[model samples]
Target: MLKSQRLIRMIMIINARKSFTVQEMADEFGLSTRTVTRDLLELSELGVPIYSIQGRGGGYRLLQERLLPPIAFTESEAVAMFIACRSLRHLSALPFDEGAESALHKFYHYLPEDSKTRIDRLKDKVAIWSPHRQVLPDCLRTLMQSIMVRSVVAIEYRSTHGVELRNIQPVGLYESDGYWYCPAYCFLREDYRVFRADRILAASLNESIDCREDVEQRTLWDLPQERAPLIPMSLELSPGGVHALRSDQWFGESIRVRDDGGGTVTVDIPSDKIPFYSDMIWRLGEDARIVAPEEAVEYVRRKIEAMRLRYS
Candidate 1:
């Protein structure tokens, strides 16, 4: 069994009886005596009321009236929660201003002393670099409320074309590139569309019923996570370009290193983001080359030609 599951089971066993011996727990869980002792120490550090007694039949027992709900977490899960809480703690717009603070307080107190110390060390090492953002959008909370009830809402949206009112049924909300986006079913367009949260000038609940039957079942995947019609791409990067790819915390996940020295890597670039890739490659100035997807090659040639003409 997983260690976390075993810890929980151990707690149940201890709580069921007035006392448990180290040998008995080791036999029950197929663990060594040292492992069982370590488990008890970890539990105690998490504020469990375990106490020891010395005698012929001596073992460990819980302090009277000090029982707590069994709780166990793997190291990865605890770290993930800490990272997420750290990311959201600064956002002022999320509902319940004090909720994140309160939760972090509880989570920090429950963490083992060692884990707490490790998290504190990580605070200095890990960083999420993004553009500054407001605490919340003008209508984020209201739009979220409408999404919760599957209610239609009338929104005054400022699109690039012009300002217009739209009646929409919100399906989901997401943040990307330092902006919030709401994917909703637009009554006027009679199709699903993504609306910038900041671009929403105003919003009000509408009496119109939400006609989207699968609103609740919709997922973020319903929107594009990557460029549509994903294309196979290959590229050769100079040593400098390779360093750029490896240094990007997000891009490094998708890159396959060609050698131990990190001299080259193969990655697929979204077709819709080719223009962006072209710009980055240009910055590399001969250090990056698109090796496949003839279309990307042609696109880059056209961009270079346009640049030359403009400069001429």
Candidate 2:
């Protein structure tokens, strides 16, 4: 077990009883007596209110009414939490940055002595690197605040088309590929839409109307539909196509890997993306046979012929 996790369990073990011998704790956690003694000492340093008896029959126990609420966890849970906190610590912007830091500190400080040592060693081993790191959106905090109060917010947003003012009911925020997006009820469009946080030039909450009561809770899929209808599509990839799928991560979530190295990838692509996928397959210069919606197959063939004639 990870020392950090063991430390948490140790607290629970000791708190469950009036007193425990080093042998008892060692037996429970599968650690050596010396290790248990070191853990108790570290717990003492952290103000766990432990008292130790001396000489024969000596053991450690917590003070009366000093028992904290039990927090039980499996080894995997502890490691997962540790890794998650480690990743979040590197994020430039988080809605709960301070809370995340405090929680991480508590997680580390209560770790078993060996686990602490392991974490120190692992710190250099693990890292979160963003190749195209974005400057955290300045409006993120304000947008979060607005969402909590269910207030309408006005934002000066810049998109590929142009800059415009948007009055939206702040709903929620999510991170995708390291960028944050806010799903909001766009007042201008009279529907829900997702806005990129980084594109929000400015934002301010509107206190006049409470739009929360009327806005139904909806998942990402429930968001307003796009102009292009979704269509069933499937593809048969060659070795290179499989490599492209793995490396490029294009339409990855829709892919299902098969046992024989090749996989079945079927998804409902937006009608507009059919042409895009055709162009992508042609660019791969690999043998990927289209297997569906005869339209896509014909589209790709024409593009290939066009390229062939251009080269010829």
Candidate 3:
């Protein structure tokens, strides 16, 4: 085989074996040990992270951070990846913030000049907008680590009520409306709850609490199934309200438009979500009228009255 082909194949083999003697590479490639040693030296110079072991029973092994084999990507595929990373630039914080930035920089730096020009032109035309929220969740990495190991974490959460400490087994995390949410099995509530990541003041492993075996298989997608009993709710929407809510991720699908350009949102949501839905509908003012579910109506009325009294 050509030297370049041999070197690439050797890199793959070394990555898989992780620890091997020079003789192993020579035997695998049917080459002389001298040639294999020279190739290994060349690989090391190319940042392959190869290190020799001087003692008995020790062989050359890659460092903990092994180099990845080169990958070939089509122009379209490369552009897609660049755009995907570009889209995430709006978020205030990311679990892999530094890694993402570095990767994007490296990827862009090596692209052909023409491709770079194309990307620059498209930057003005294409965008995936996410709301720019200022709140940063410093504990995002800790929370992510807990999810990976399925471990219980004790967290100091600052909610509207007050700061409270709770032990939780995180299911998964999701981003919506410019905020990160961690859905977890809360030991305090003994139920599944969604906590805003920004509200998490601190998080650390809690060895005192055992993670629930039942929730080990749970994920963010399974949250709807884990909800309390659903309660039917309906809203009558004017034309303006229909237009305003058409973009709502949560309620957009529930709206049914009429010939008059008006619409109605009718859906069953868990009772625990009533307060959130009420606040959303209340913000629509006259454009939206709550049609059913006296609970939500009452909540909105109480809010309106409270605001009135506060202003008075």
Candidate 3 lDDT by residue in tens digits, 188-236: 9888888988888888888778888888888766674645789888999
What shift in Å separates residue 19 of candidate 1 from its native position after superposition? 39
> Model 2: per-residue lDDT, tens digit, 1-312?
787878777777777887989898888878889998899999888668899989898887678646464476665576778777788756667764375677778878887887778667777477765434464545887788887666888898898779999898866787755677888888888877778888888888877756755563654556656668988778777666676666444456666666666666776777876886766666656546677768898998887789899999
lDDT of 1 by residue, 1-312 (tens): 998888888877888876889999999998999999999999899767889989889999888634545557798888988888777644535533355666778888878899999999888467564445663444887788787667888999988689999999888887754567788878998777888887888887886665567655677676535534666666677666777666654345555656643444446676776665666556666766877677778888898899999999
Candidate achieving the largest lDDT? 3
Q: For candidate 2, give the lDDT of residue 112.
A: 82
TM-score, candidate 1, is 0.51
List the candidate 3 regions with Cα displacement exceeding 4 Å: 18-23, 31-67, 134-138, 206-213, 224-227, 283-287, 306-312
Per-prediction TM-score to the true structure, in the order listed: 0.51, 0.58, 0.82
Give the whole-model CA lDDT for all candidates, comma-separated. 0.74, 0.74, 0.85
What is the Å distance of residue 90 in model 2 from its true position?
Answer: 4.6
Candidate 2 structure, TM-score to reference: 0.58
